[model samples]
Structure formats: C-alpha cells, structure tokens
Target: MWVVAQAPPETPVGPEFGKASPVGLFILVVLGVVILGIGYAFHRRLSRFNRRRLFAEQHGIDPFDREAIDAAMEEAGLRDLSRTSYL
Candidate 1:
C-alpha cells in the first residue's frame, strides 16, 4: 500500500482582512489630532510659566507668587487677550 502527502491550504486575501477601514483611519486621525492639541496646550502653559518666572526674577519677586506674577504682567501691559474684554 502507498501513502500520499497532502499540502496545507493557503489563507485567502480579502478586503475585510489586512486593511484599515475608512472609519478606523478617521478615528486614528482624530486621536492623533487630540494628542497634538493636548501637547500644544501643555507647551503653551509651560512657556507662559517660564516667561512669568523670568519676569519675576528680573523684578526681584518670588516666581511662585501668583498675585505678584499677575500684577507684574498687568503692570507691564502683557496680559493675555483672552482674559481681557474690549467692549
């Protein structure tokens, strides 16, 4: 009697597999945008803090004093536009 060897079946490639859908791509893009936005906000806050610290050092004031920093910024006319109203 003779025995025969059989080969394994190959996996079929289709649109549903091994491909990113439009909705998935959109979600990824949205997540990336959100992360970037958060990073930008953090950077802006850090820069503002640094600037306030430098200003405080220049004027011989405590950098951690919120009131002093605000007063210095206000006295220098360097207030953020978002906090001021022009009516």
Candidate 2:
C-alpha cells in the first residue's frame, strides 16, 4: 500500500509536466530587476561614503562627526548622498 502511494522516481508525472509557465518566467524577471536595483543602490551609497570619507580626511575632520560632516557638505553645495533619501 505504501509503495502504491509513493511518488514516481526520476521522471515527472503531471498535467503540465516539463513545461515552464509564463507567470513563473515573469516572477524570475521581476526578481532579477529587484536584485539589480538593490545592487545599484548599494554601489551608489558606497560611492557617496567614499567621497564623504575622503572629504573628511582631507580636512582633518573625524569621519564619525555627523554634525561637522553635514555642515561641510552643506558648505560645499553637496547633498547628503549617503542617506537613503537619495535612493
């Protein structure tokens, strides 16, 4: 009885066997787009961080000093690119 209820081995047995649906393909494409977007955002944020760190280091300011960094960024006509608001 248990053998009778067991699944088929090595071969699929279904109505739409070996066929991929359009909806599944669409979900995969959407997931790819989402991953690309996240990667882009990460790269952008990292670039901004590097710029900010360089700026702070050049001017002898502490990298962790948010208030000073904000003031310097403002003085240089630069926006807070490291913030998620830019994304």
Candidate 3:
C-alpha cells in the first residue's frame, strides 16, 4: 500500500505591507510630531489673541483698530508697523 500527502493552498499577501516600511513608519511618526508641535504653538498664540481681544472688548476698545496700535507703537518707540510682518 502507498500513501500520498497533499499540501495546503497558499494565501496571497496584502497591499498594506508594501506601503508601510520601517523607514516610512519612522517618517510618518516624525511628521505627526512636527504637526502636533505646530498645532500646539498656533493654539497658544490663538489663546493669547483671544485673551487680549476679550480684555479690549471689556474696556470698550476695538481690537482691530490698527491706528491705536500704531500710535501706541510710536509712543513707545518700538518696532514700526510698516516693517513688521505677522507669522
């Protein structure tokens, strides 16, 4: 009597394995960290702006009045508004 053994069928690989290599995973983590840092900085800045706006509003002052800012800057002899740029 002779006995034969049969092999099982193989499974196909998926696409996710190809897209996410070790280097790609590292890059994605680094990019996420940088984006998080930038978002935190922007949030802090916005919070400060909101606080200032609220204070101005409480004092019956118009926060968007550029003339008032320019005049204050002129009185203080600080950086000129014409040469300064916002981030």
The best candidate by TM-score is 2
Give lDDT tens digits, candidate 3, residues 1-87. 997876657645687644656898899999999999889877866775675566556656688875775565566565453443344
Candidate 2 per-residue lDDT, tens place, 15-64, comes to: 98999989999999999999999999888878988899999998889998
| Per-candidate local distance difference test | 0.78, 0.86, 0.66
Q: Which of the two, 1 or 3, has more lDDT?
A: 1
- Across 9-39, the per-residue lDDT of candidate 1 in tens digits comes to 8775687878867999899999999999889
Off by over 4 Å in 3: 1-20, 66-87
Q: So what's the TM-score on candidate 2?
A: 0.74
| TM-score for each candidate, following the candidate numbering | 0.69, 0.74, 0.52
Evaluate residue 35 in candidate 2 and report its C-alpha lDDT on the 0 to 100 scale: 100
Better of 1 and 2 by lDDT: 2
Q: What's the TM for model 3?
A: 0.52
